[model samples]
Target: MHGLPQAEPTNATIRPGAAARRSPGWRISRRVRIGLASLIGTFALWWLLTDITGVIGPHRFPAPAEFWAAFVQIAIDGYAGGTLITQAWYSTRLVIMGFLVAIATGVPLGLLMGVSHRAEALLNPAFLLVRPIPPLAWIPLAIVWLGLGDAAKILVIWFAAFVPSVINTWTGVRGVDRTLIAAARVHGAGELRLLWEVIIPGSLPMMFTGLRLSLQASWTTLVAAELVGAFFGLGRVLDAAYRDINPPMIAVAMLAVGVLGALTTRLVAVAERRLIPWRS
Candidate 1:
């Protein structure tokens, strides 16, 4: 016993405090729980209104259970010429394709107009002249010019998304701090370097705002474009529902749009948070 090492203390086996520190804090976890509870409560209220109380007839409004049932049935059995997911993909592809093209061209052109006098002189007036026209009004003209294919729909969405992209991007670039630009120049940063290092980062916040707006525009325009003549899309489903006066199908499409919009907006917020550490 004299030479034996003492046994390690059993008290040192673990630290509950350390584990607690790694877990979420009360405020954040509580807020998340509350938000989820509120969402479920809203759905529950709708269910009660239609099903239990019958104050709202099921014909006029499907219960939550019935709506979800219809959703699943459409997803599996195929509605509006294809399954719900299939239709969603058709709409989503159109939105993303047109939205991407709009931002790709619009943001760069906007930045150029903001920074270059010649570009602004040449492009600004025409842009100002055309931008105020309603996005949906382009649908008929696009169909005539591009034909009633995906190209026409894409053109419509592009017009809808492009305006917001250019306007916001221009605002961001034009609002860049002149002092920062001057400082970059004084520090021996060249024209390219000044733009890359000073202007772009400063303008990212506004550009991100534009992206959110473009997202909304893309969705709204896609729905309109689809209504004109689409083989498969939520808008087409809504069109049918309108004709049939099918409340359940209408509710499904409406809910789908709301959910998609919320999720995408949340994703953009997350991306902004991660990408722009300076903001936080």
Candidate 2:
């Protein structure tokens, strides 16, 4: 009996390559390869349609070379008296301002509503009414109230972001485990302790989800807000390009919006990883 070899765990035999599959680096590398392939394939199709076939006219859609030329021109020579960098920064700044304000205001109010039935009853109906309204709808009122300034732009962006933040946060808090709440209560945890230890930690993932959504909303609304009266922003760049019938410049501006949005989303992802490392 002492000389007999010990049996290998049954689980080990069933999970071949499981460790490799579970490796974080392996997963990340796989995702990177897939994403790169997708981008390359898209660009190849675009190039084929525009440059090779010429089925799509330059006036309708700029070729890759034209797009590159337009990008370089805006990056160096400037457009409407502002370089692309400055214009993109203007839009990004508005997004940041509005996003931060939404987070600051929405999270606390959401927490209140989540914990208090009375508060929820009082606020939920109003939020429901406002949630269906489009951010673009706020543009006319914003111009009237705040004029053609950054304030008007920020207001529009703020409204776009605020609803998602509050809704997601509220939903997150409400989604916290009732069993955990009961256990905490049984253990004589006070309401504040229950909130801090049991609720907030549990709800953080959803809260961060809300933040990401809010940031996206901010970027999307920034473009529309700037379209109305901004002197310097990607949206204004787009407007000018349209008025001049310059497809290349329009393509450049649209690309800038997409790139900037992606960059900001990356920033939010980094923050999410830092704040919620367990989930990451």
Candidate 3:
């Protein structure tokens, strides 16, 4: 055994992270568990306050049974000659139309402004002038121009969505690394190629941020947008409920709006993940 060299340890002999690989781990995360518990506790508290103690009356806040009854009434008996589904569809349709229009125009304009100083100089003044005005302010002009129809509502919603999209996109594009752009130029990449390959990719994260904001803006503006001419929408339902002094109906409509906003925002997140797979 004198002067004999020892054999090197093989991977088969030493397995790092073997325990980690074997462990099933917690299937449900702590955050998720806490969230579930919080929701359950909140509902329990609401039940206690409303049903058990009667401290909160149905006039102020509907009990679970009252809420359910209102939901059924709207679902079955309908509201303003349109069922809940019909109203929801109308609102969703308006949102989609306005949202699409906003992105279609806003993205290109933002990109152009970001890429060319001349474009920014020419447009920035007007953009700045108009951007500060709230979307609600446009309602009167929309009514005068497009009349009391879907177009007017869409216009208002478009304004709501457009500002953030442009601002965010422009910021995103401008924020792209100058070094990368210069490197791309050194590699003989033309303006178009540089924009497509580098600029868009670099800017996508902020662009998506803009998109999410735009989506929220669309939903937030929906109720106001529908105020003028909409005969059937969640906004209309809320308005009608308020007019009729029906607290349960108002709660149901508000819940519907909240649910729809959440669903749409989720869709945008899904799209962002699909398009920007590299983002964590």
Candidate 4:
């Protein structure tokens, strides 16, 4: 007994279970509930103002019920002999292609500019001059160069998405802590190794921020691009509805665009959360 070791109590080990895992879902549901409530309240106010007060005539600002009915009809019957699904698919494809092009060019260019003063000096002025020009302004040039097809739409979206990504990536790379670079060098890390390991990891958060902004810009520009001189997109559907003075159809198109944009933004947010898990 004098030489024996004493046994220790384990206490009640309280490890998290499935219930704890479910808490995130509950939190998400609570937030969704709040959002839905707010949307419902806002729509109620809109309906009351339009229907009861008659501040804006029903002919001009059609009743919310009418819009809802129209939206349902369009969803069921499709638009301009083409399904809403078709138009949405076309727009989504163009956006994705354009976004990919932007990232391919912008990220490398940004990294070059960030790492090399000469590259920045050579390219920055041109980018600054070009960036201020709106995507709509490029529509004429895009049409001239690529014509009234998928190519033109994709080009317009690329222009819209590229600038923010390049600027943000450049900023991120430039902002990497100098001490990390020195330490990497001290450890005999080669330029490529340092860049891949130290610089990229450090700069990833800002790059993701840029990516999110680029996606938003791409979504906004897609409608404008389709409206200018093209067919088979949500924007084109909206344009046709406007021309026909079909307010309900117009509302449906608008709602579709808003939902798609919100969904894209949320997807990007999810990616950001997963990729940058260290961030609060």
CA lDDT, every prediction? 0.83, 0.88, 0.87, 0.83
Structure candidate 4, residue pairs in collision: none
Q: Could you tell me how far off, in angstroms, the CA of residue 248 lies in candidate 3 after the best superposition?
A: 0.7
Question: For candidate 4, lDDT tens digit of each residue in 155-247?
Answer: 888898998889889999999999999999999999999999988888888898898888888988889887777768898998888888888
Sort by lDDT, best first.
2, 3, 1, 4
lDDT of 3 by residue, 1-280 (tens): 3363333345325663443343347245657878999989988998899999999998898888898899999999898657889998889989999999999988888899999999999999999899889988888898899887788888888999999899999999999999999999999999899999999999999999999999999988878866555677999898888888888889899999998999999999999999898877
Per-residue accuracy of model 1 over 20-60 as CA lDDT, tens digit each: 54444533565677899999999888978888898899788
Model 2: CA > 4 A from native: 1-28
Model 1 regions lying over 4 Å from their true place: 1-28
* Clash pairs (backbone) in predicted model 1: none
As for candidate 2, its clashing pairs are: none
- Judging by lDDT, tell me the better candidate of 3 and 4: 3
What is the alpha-carbon lDDT for the whole of candidate 3? Answer: 0.87
* Positional deviation of residue 160's Cα in model 2 after best superposition, in angstroms: 1.0
Winner by TM-score between candidate 3 and candidate 1: 3
Model 3 TM-score on a 0 to 1 scale: 0.88
